[model samples]
Target: MEQTEDEGYHKLDHQLCFPLYAASRLVTKCYQPVLDELGLTYPQYLVLMVLWESDAVNLSRLSERLKLQSNTLTPLLKRMEELGLLTRQRSKQDERSIIIALTEKGKSLKSEVPRLQQQLMDIGISKEEAIQLKGLLTKMINYISG
Candidate 1:
């Protein structure tokens, strides 16, 4: 049998991964302006979301949840602390670990996030579409991670 040179080679247009990567980057860029107004970066916004859901998470746990390394998270957390958005204190029970807690300012920002996120949703996707998109993303991530 004759074989084409293209067999087993990669093609950008046909790759599902590229769309996921591109969409992720674009979505992060879209969030940048909204987050900037709150004095936050996309990663910081992610941290805020995690902390908003549960306020006093340990450093390691936050890093794991956010898929960040301790070195990277440490600086980000420090910056958040300097911005008066959150507080970092060494755990009294285990001095080796640190606890990150949202400050009043950070807690107050939660109300504004819904409005900002809604704006993105309204412009980028409908509510029903967004739910379906979320499910699709979850499935993709789970499959890739698995």
Candidate 2:
């Protein structure tokens, strides 16, 4: 009934979550310099990317898309608004909902994204591997979220 030391349950490597957490942080760190040039934090960059794709989206829809709660998104949106990167307006059809639209400034940042994506791609992940990794990660996320 004895378990080997390698089977130790408390080790950091034994936790499935640890690698995911560490990798997320490291990958984000690699993005810091490029993000700094755009004057955006990682989360803010994510928000901008989403808005660039679906401008004039409502708060709840945006929250769903980003997997963020409305409270968490509100403050970030406020900061982006103050930076003149976006505008927040009450939805005419539903006063209870807020619509988010990127300002010209925010839309302009989209042009920089291709360069950022290219830089990351150059960091050694092959196209096939990148596709596979994305598929695996998306599957894990869907399973976990479900």
Candidate 3:
């Protein structure tokens, strides 16, 4: 059998993953300037967000929540610690585990997030569309994760 140009498998646009991959990168680029003001990379920002929501959590818990491996999160956490944004220490209850907690500076970053979110919301789409998109993306994530 001969495959033609119109074959679904041959077109980039027909692939389900490309759009998600591109959009993820584009959204991260949009966040770059905003995160730069805080001297944070996108992954670091995500870590702060999770820690901001829960004051202290063990490395394993954080890894689970962020969908990252401990090895991946460790370097980011170390940089944040060096920057005085957070601290990592052995957990009292489980000496083998490390707990990550934000510093006052990290906590203060919460105030800037509202403006960042507002800027993201104003990115050429209606609020309703944004909400629908989030829902759809979340559903896709859940399906894939399962």
Candidate 4:
């Protein structure tokens, strides 16, 4: 009996993208409890991380940095603002431009990041392995983006 070309190759586990997608979802799931303590969702946490690095950035700049669209980000930003975590206001220099700035509450969340990171790292990957994985993923991202 001859095996068809599709027989072995069609398995989901054999696909490169499947593991990456699964890992991404699993990692995000692990983050849920940690983020919940701070009343944040994963995307909201990511937005806060960017703002923590640069306190005030225009919407376009933020959207570019986060690799998200304004339409998607706008609703997230509005929710964050409503939560008293951050604020969005029109830039004085350009009325058309909107600036996003972290509030005191937002700034306070930076202290919790280390704990969240540690919790994720507890999944058994060593520091060196984590760094290497991050580097590989970043390379893949850059290549695909290019």
Best-performing candidate as measured by lDDT: 4
Q: Which of the two candidates, 2 or 3, achieves a greater TM-score against the reference?
A: 2
Query: Which residue runs of candidate 4 sit more than 4 Å off their true CA positions?
Result: 1-9
- Over the stretch 51-143, how does candidate 3's per-residue lDDT look in tens digits? 999878899999988889999999999999999999999988889999999999999999999867765765777889988999998897788
Give the per-residue lDDT digits (tens) of candidate 2, residues 1-146. Answer: 35478797667877777988987898888888899988999999998988988777899989988889999999999999999999999989999999999999999999998867755766567889989988999998889778
Q: Could you give candidate 4's per-residue lDDT for residues 54-85 as a string of tens digits? A: 88899999888777899999999999999999
TM-scores vs. true structure, each candidate: 0.84, 0.90, 0.90, 0.89
Q: Residue 31 in model 3: shift from native, Å?
A: 1.2
Give the clashing residue pairs of candidate 1, or none: none
Whole-model Cα lDDT of every candidate shown, in order? 0.83, 0.87, 0.88, 0.89
Stretches > 4 Å off in candidate 2: 1-6
- Output the better candidate (1/3) by TM-score: 3
lDDT for residue 17 in candidate 2, whole number 0-100:
78
